[model samples]
Target: MTRSLPALMLGAALVGLSAPAALAQSAPMEMHAMTAAPALNLSAYGEVKVAPDMATITFGVMTEAPTAQAAMADNARRMQEVFAALGRAGIADRDIQTSGLNLSPQYDYVQNEPPKLRGYQASNRVTVNIMDLTKVGTTADAVVSAGVNQIDGIAFGLKDPKAAEDQARVLAVRALQDKARLYAQALGVELGAVRTLNEGGGYQPPQPMPMYAARMQMAESDSTPVAAGQLAVRIDITGTYDLGR
Candidate 1:
């Protein structure tokens, strides 16, 4: 049997009323789910100072002669002597690297006259890693005496920077946590667990220090003096911490 028109109308009205009630009941729950907890975002850095255990020195032999072949031959011979000196100074073949070798024509420029060819100049540059700090000065002296006329630069560094980087990472995390705590205390809130963490910076090698070739040419009785200063390893970190209470 079919329901009466009035009963059907009543049922439809009841259904409409229940739909709004259900939506109203669930609205607060949906809003609560969508709301995120308060977060404190912070960034911090850490640094560690350490003495360098090794050094890299770039030096070369420059030769000038009337002919290109003569200039190159002279440069090669002097480079050989420099290599021998390095070997005697306890530098391994693996530590020695040829950075550059160039031969160029020299010219004399005169006013109201075209450039005149003077001679050919050749240069052979080598970069050597000295593991022993004590031998740095002696090695320089030996190479200079053997045939190194150009001293490009010197850079000091660690044999292994992993330990230093890890130490800096620890310090960075501690600093971040401290900052979060301080912020939380200031806001009169409790610090919660770390929501996210990101790491950025790491160990960066220092730039090579300039050294004059004349200064490297000390007296025969005295070796070249080299000072390996301290190096700073740094770490940067950013974190997101939850706030509670």
Candidate 2:
């Protein structure tokens, strides 16, 4: 037996589907059609305090001698020690990056004389990422003890920051809702569904507070106190809502 929908039933189904769409399409694109026109926008700044799961140390070797070759040899010898220590600490070669290298003449200045060129200086910088935080302090100490004189800086941050970013997004949404509610209450209008949303800014990862003087010397025995302060992840959202009548 062949069965077909009646004209009336088919007409009703079509009408039901089209009605809401039609309303949505022709619902008077009103950017401004309300009493006591009020625009309320809110922004919130939230921070998450997390111990740095990872750390980075930028330090290099600087050597000076009467000859360029001698300077380079000194630099290479000390740098090899640094690499050896890093390997002992279980830092993979892939995580180590040779950031910079330079060889220049050492110049001396006199009160009333032309600058005299003393010798050649060879410098090389290496950047290493320590995946393990438990050994960050000791690792830093080890590197310095191995003749890494110039500790450019030590920074701490998260390896995976997606979780923190998600939390920040939720905070942004909640901030928007609070704004909407406050605006609706003040304008004596009902709260409405969001029609548009704009996120002006994304979350910024936590920055490491630089932890030491100009350079960390090898002689210092106390472990550097690295405090990973709270990282403020801010998300700015601009949202437009459909007003209720």
Candidate 3:
């Protein structure tokens, strides 16, 4: 005997398969309705001024000689002296880092001719982190006295900025929430849950201070003038809030 499905049973099976796709289409519509819900966008910025507690200075010794080996040797000797001076200034070995070391041949360009080899130049740059702001001037003096002929520049920063930045972020979010609530009240609508929160800004890294050619030299009585101005730690945030009926 041949057996076939009844018309009503076959129709029910087809409907069951298509029910999932119908739900899929309605799912997007539901999400679209949620996205289109009335909402308020708020942005707030917060900044806190804090005096720098630490300073970083980059300075080095540059030497020139007829041979690369000679130049390198002279540079090494001067750097060793500078390292000793830095150690005496209460800088830890971990805080002193060799930022750069290079040996390049000096070239002299002639009119319409190939460059001539003048001499070999070697440079060793060291970066020192001073935890005490009061030692900024004295440290610079010490390094210069120990034969740091080239100075890149100095930058002032905080040793730990996480706490300050966290406070700023909290303030920014609070300000944003306050604003959102005030707007909602004025518009005669209840404030609903937050739809989205975005961090628009945060603390900026330290920047190199201005370079002074005259400050690099000392006559054994002069100390480098280092002024660590207050750095601003800023935070900005944006929040989207849904409107309740």
Measured by TM-score, the strongest candidate is: 1
lDDT by residue (tens digit), candidate 1, 69-187:
99999999989899998998999999999999999999999999999999999999999999999999899889988988888888999999999999999999999989999999999
lDDT for each residue of candidate 2 in 99-199, tens digit (9 for 90 to 100): 99999998999999999999999999998888987777777777777888777777776788778767777877887788788878878888777766777
Q: How close to the true structure is residue 173 of candidate 2, measured as C-alpha lDDT? A: 83
How high a TM-score does candidate 3 get? 0.82
Q: What TM-score would each prediction reach against the true structure?
A: 0.84, 0.73, 0.82
Better of 1 and 3 by TM-score: 1
lDDT of each: 0.92, 0.75, 0.87
> Worst lDDT window (10 residues) for model 2?
30-39
**Residue 51, candidate 2: C-alpha displacement in angstroms:** 3.2
Off by over 4 Å in 2: 1-46, 203-208, 213-225
lDDT of 3 by residue, 110-170 (tens): 9999999999999999988889989988888888889988888889988888888988898
Which portions of model 3 show Cα errors greater than 4 Å?
A: 1-35, 216-219
How many clashes in each candidate?
0, 0, 0
Model 1: runs farther than 4 Å from truth? 1-35
Candidate 3 residue 105 Cα shift, in angstroms, is: 1.1
Q: Cα lDDT for residue 224, model 2?
A: 54
